[model samples]
Target chain A: MNKIFETPLYPYRRAPEQDEERIMRHKVVVVGAGPIGLAAAIDLARNDIPVLVIDDNDKVSFGSRAICFAKRPLEILDRLGAGDAMVEKGVEWELGRVFFGEREVYRFNLLPEAGHKRPAFINLQQYYFEEFLVRRLRELEAEGRPVEIRGRNKLAAIGAHEDHVTLEIDTPEGPYNLETEWLIAADGAGSPTRRMMGLDFVGKVFEDNFLIADVIMQADFPTERWFWFDPPFNRGQSALLHKQPDNVWRIDFQLGWDIDREHELKPENIDRRLRAMLGEDIRYELEWSSIYTFQCRRMETFRKGRVIFAGDSAHQVSPFGARGANSGLQDTDNLVWKLRLVIEGNAPESLLDSYDFERILAADENILNSTRSTDFITPKSEISRILRDAVLDLSAEHEFARPLVNSGRLSVPAVYDGSPLNTADALDGPAISRPGAPCPDAPLGEGFLLERLGDRFILLTIDADAPDEIEEDGITVTRLALSVRDDTTGALKRRYLGDEPSAVYLIRPDQHVAARRPSWNENLFRAAIRRATGKE
Target chain B: MTDLILTPNLDNADDFYATLLAAHEGLTKKESDALHARLILILANHIGDNKLLEQAIEAARKAG
Candidate 1:
């Protein structure tokens, strides 16, 4: 058998006991060096904030987990300076085909429109993602940024206080204590931190089990998502196939709840199933396989005092929609900027409340969608199965029925429609780029719109004169004007200005639209800035 | 949207009608009615537009 990909392990270094006794405290301590934890650490370090990341494991990840990367997370990774490498190493796909029985019922293109910087989704092993993020962290550290990652270290206890949080960590050398002004718990689904805090998840636990297998083979399958409902090979069950890099194929089999896991994972049983799915002519090696039953649950509150929860530690969803890791990355994206400002004493601590509000909304949306998809895929009752089949049958001939066929509605960035940070739409040109939406990427002068908007407040003026620089209260405004020279194909005008002649947009550091107006006034812009920063 | 047309929409309408009648040939009246009810639900789910399905329901009731 060909050798499977494995993450390189780092040795655990002993820490001096005096280091823990030092009066100096770290700005942020992130528990778990998974993708979400590493991403959080990098985001903070990029903002010139030092962060310490601890994990119980020394390697990146055990197997090919969390294989789907949505465009929104890619854009967030781009901000962290690791987006291009991920995209280049992953398989880019935008089309998906849904099959019922023996026939193809529906096909959808995620990105039918153009002028976007990244594709709709990419498929890469989770280990590769963590490895790339660790590399980027090392690069940032070489450039004088503080990002310390300590492997083989586990959090034993957590104490949250009014001013800071104290942590007891068990390392290879010995156990020690550390202090941090803020704590981010990205410790994944079985989060020990959450358990130590005596908090329980509140939501639904699905009964259906799924077997995910990563097979290394040279197959001639297209790089599009293929979903099967009651496929012939897997009778009365659903299956999914996705192509990952390194010639690895991820296949998911919907195994009903009543099966012996050990028996199902036996080599002979797995080989028989694989032979049934792939013809005898195709030879392959199984790289990894695991069984999982997911739950759609979240903590009651993501933020409690000085400790905050991001990723699976705060929320979890079924893997149907690939919402698990993507939503977690967005949490880090929304959090690190607010945490940075709060740590620097530029913004009040109340700004962190918005993180909970916004991410809770996103988590709810993901759970809702994931639950619906699961229900459709595995109907609990006979009546629902009939209805699901009816919808699938009609989707082949009718346009209206296509939307009803839910084969895992792929992950899309959550739009913060009712966020308190948004300045109400007193003036609006296009509803697509309205308040609380992620700023749409467009072509600028020899670059992208997102590339120009740095980690600071931006006043983007379209078809109007750019304003002079304004810096106040630790907030500096960088202005850019969109002209014919900047947008040659008029993608920017079409996206930002539907029909209006001129418009001014206030964008937060995280690239979400804070407010927009047809005309620019210093007072209105400043007021929106203040509201976004939690000063209002 | 309220109008219903019983035209030759299928390529082999006569053959389909024959098959439809033959499908109920061996069934009792109660069984036939149950099959018709199931067929109605299946088609209604396919034509997912609630407004159009409601219009069709009203038309079927009026015809009955």
Candidate 2:
């Protein structure tokens, strides 16, 4: 029997009356309980910053949405203690094949190089992703970290101030007022919080529509991404098929702009389309179906005084590239650390400005890539279609044209090339893992390099010894030395040291490289730290 | 590498040009433009090197 996912409703509890003598104030209050908000809550709670998360709904996501989890998000999740469960429940895949009309045009491997800690990508339902994060949050709460989750509570109104923000929340019984020092608005795409604040998401909305369906079947298809452009099965349109956990598959059929959504979603029509794509003999059961048109847009500013936006509330993109949830998780990953420092009085509020700058750049990158993919998949004019078809026809015979085939350019980690927090590159090191980039993971001793960093600044040394301890201001610097261990297999040297005998890398609490030099100096290290914390 | 191929490479250049023109015959202006766009993409894909493609694009943009 195929297992069907059911969203369990949480019972609502009455809030304390507004006339109470004193109301509880939290350091951070996250507005949504989706993947992004929950990740931020978990990060803040893990850092011992008390967080309260309020959600209008109680259950997990309803359908199989946002199935692709990229490596960078996985790394971030691992830091939050939920990575192993997701990897265990997900179908890991890296190979993708693109076809034009029945002929195989090109194939690509996402992670051709090996020795990384995480896989290239994993395919799992969005509900399971949120459930795993909620589980991790409960584990942290059990350990006496002040992380509270209140469901069935909606944010009715919001007022921002220079010092804090006041929120009016409506519960099942009545309404109550709450105040928080920092507000993380992670409420999803149609964010009520964003609407309440009168902020607009500005960008382009593609005219094309896509039909997404989740079906459960026992078939022997290879566990890889298969995308067809104008295939015989679906005439003159595009189709994508991906394997997920529990013998379920996700199929997307691109319908033109003039589709009758209601008529297309009928059971008989869906069955006919599935039959045409998967053949009559393959007996399958439908799990879910939806019609969607996506927009590649973002808010003008991610940080607005005391009210900060993350995830879909701040930016949105088409689902073609699997960048939506992955980038949202990254937004929270980039945000929580800065918020924690600012809340702890260790870093100035100016540090949060860097978060806005860096993530806006990242959002722009995702939007640009997503727009290109949308344009390629659904050509607006005859000229565009002609060029797209020519590229497809030539890709089968040539390797160079394969890169131009953008069947959703899969998500990759964004490098902050000109981030204000990045220190100048004074050392000759591997360009692949540079300042402002996430530190590449390699085996160190019995653990991984990423496992040794984060939660505090790290001064990582490869093939060299550093001082026993370095602590300045409120930042605790942990010194880690990695040499040619049996498990390393020269990965550490290749990734960090390059040709140098010894090198020092300064990594931030978010595991982003802050600076690097051939040799370590206390004054220079302090200067880099000052710059990273916005002291300079 | 120099992108200019001054040497004669095609064996039947006259026939190839005739066929190319024939492919455009009887097409409207919009259709001809679409065909030209497709031909450009196909030929660029055939010449896979990006540096060479850049040089070719610059050379084509320059007026004689």
Candidate 3:
């Protein structure tokens, strides 16, 4: 049963502010309650910033739109108190097989190592992901945090004033006026807020159409990603099959550039294709189906005055590599801390320009990868098609050709290289854990290093001397001392220390490496704290 | 930047040309194009250096 979509999780209710005449002002107002919007709201509310989220619909999204959740976003969710629930209800897989015709040519393991807390990727329905975020928001509400989600509240109009944003919200009762010091637009690809502000994105629109069908069956296919190129079932096209929780499988078929979508979406036609794929004897139920065309594009800048855009509203990409939603979660992960600091007067308003620099680079990288994948998969030109078929043919017998095969590059966290906020690297540490890189998770005695790091600016000293705490301006930087003996696996030494015996790292609140050195120096730490917080 | 290698690199010119032509026997024009595509890709990958391959591409386009 598709219970998640049919039920109204956040039904419309009459709020007291609707009856009042004066406009209600909030610390932050978030538009749309999708995964990105909810994440931003939860992060802000958890940090004691009052936030209100509004959405037109009252339930989790209609269908399972996005199904792949990568690890870095999962780590971000964990920081927001919703990670374990998602991992528990999700299907984790690292094995993926790429098939040419009927033979499997390329097999890949996304994560080949151990000693990490989360898997490389997980397959879970978007509805479950949204539900988990809403549940976490409810838990925070129970803890008396100032957060609210108003269903059937549509942001009909928006205007940016000098230091705030004004909104005219349409509700079940009627239209009400609201104002917020800062506005976050987490609306989806067709963002009304963006349209209201006379903003548009410059990008490439792919002509290909992809039909996605979520089917329920008791088939015995192993829990792995299987991609087919020029298979007998769908000749001259590509298909993808992935397993989700509770015997639901996501099957995506490329329908080329020109086709009657109505004819293709017919029940009998869909059934015929499914039968051809799963043999004639298997019986299954169609849970959901959709036809989508994607574009790789983004706004010139994510922030405009007091209004900031996040998620698909700010950037959009094709779903082949599952870059759409994964990058959306990362947007909010990079945003909330800066918003919090700005709201509390801890950091200057210019601190948000770093968000634009970092996330836009990530969006460009995602667009580049997904566009390449789309070109390889679709091959719009005859010459492109020939080259693609060549790679597929050679991959059957050649090990070198396997890497040339492009099913999808998949999603990985973008390392913010040359970010303005990062201090100069003082230690020749591991390249993977350098300045502006996310802190790699290392196993502590009973937990993980990231868990101990939490959401704060920290001075991490390994086998080195450091003060207990240091405060710069209004922000506090605490020290977490560790030894090589803490981790028996030597991941701590290998990932952080490398050949250096002693090391010190200044970690940002977003868990990015702001600076690092061989050992702690009082003057360097003070200057670094200033630079990392935008006081310099 | 270095120019494309214009001189002959293969040892057996006649034998290799014969083998290349024979591989396309009994194939249609589309099939022949596919063979050329595969051949070019395999040979290009064997060279592995992107700069050299780009130079080769430039030479071929210029010749056309």
User: Which candidate number has the best lDDT?
Assistant: 3
Across A36-154, the per-residue lDDT of candidate 1 in tens digits comes to: 99999999998889898888877887778899998889989998999999999999777888899988888987664577787778899998898899899889989999888888888
Off by over 4 Å in 2: A1-5, A17-21, A106-111, A205-207, A485-487, B1-52, B58-64
Candidate 3 per-residue C-alpha lDDT over A60-79 given as tens digits, one digit per residue, 9 for 90 to 100:
98778899998888899999
The DockQ value obtained for model 3 is 0.75
Ranking by TM-score: 3, 2, 1
Ordered from best to worst DockQ, the candidate numbers read 3, 2, 1
A427-480: candidate 2 lDDT, tens digit per residue: 898997789988888877667778878567888887666786787788778888
Return model 2's CA RMSD, one decimal: 3.0
Task: Quantify all predictions' global Cα lDDT against the true fold.
Answer: 0.84, 0.85, 0.90
**Can you give the lDDT of residue A50 in candidate 2?**
93
Runs of candidate 3 with Cα error greater than 4 angstroms are: A109-111, A205-207, B1-27, B55-64
Please state the error at residue A74 of candidate 2 in Å.
0.7
Q: Which sections of candidate 1 miss by over 4 Å?
A: A1-9, A17-24, A106-111, A205-207, B1-64
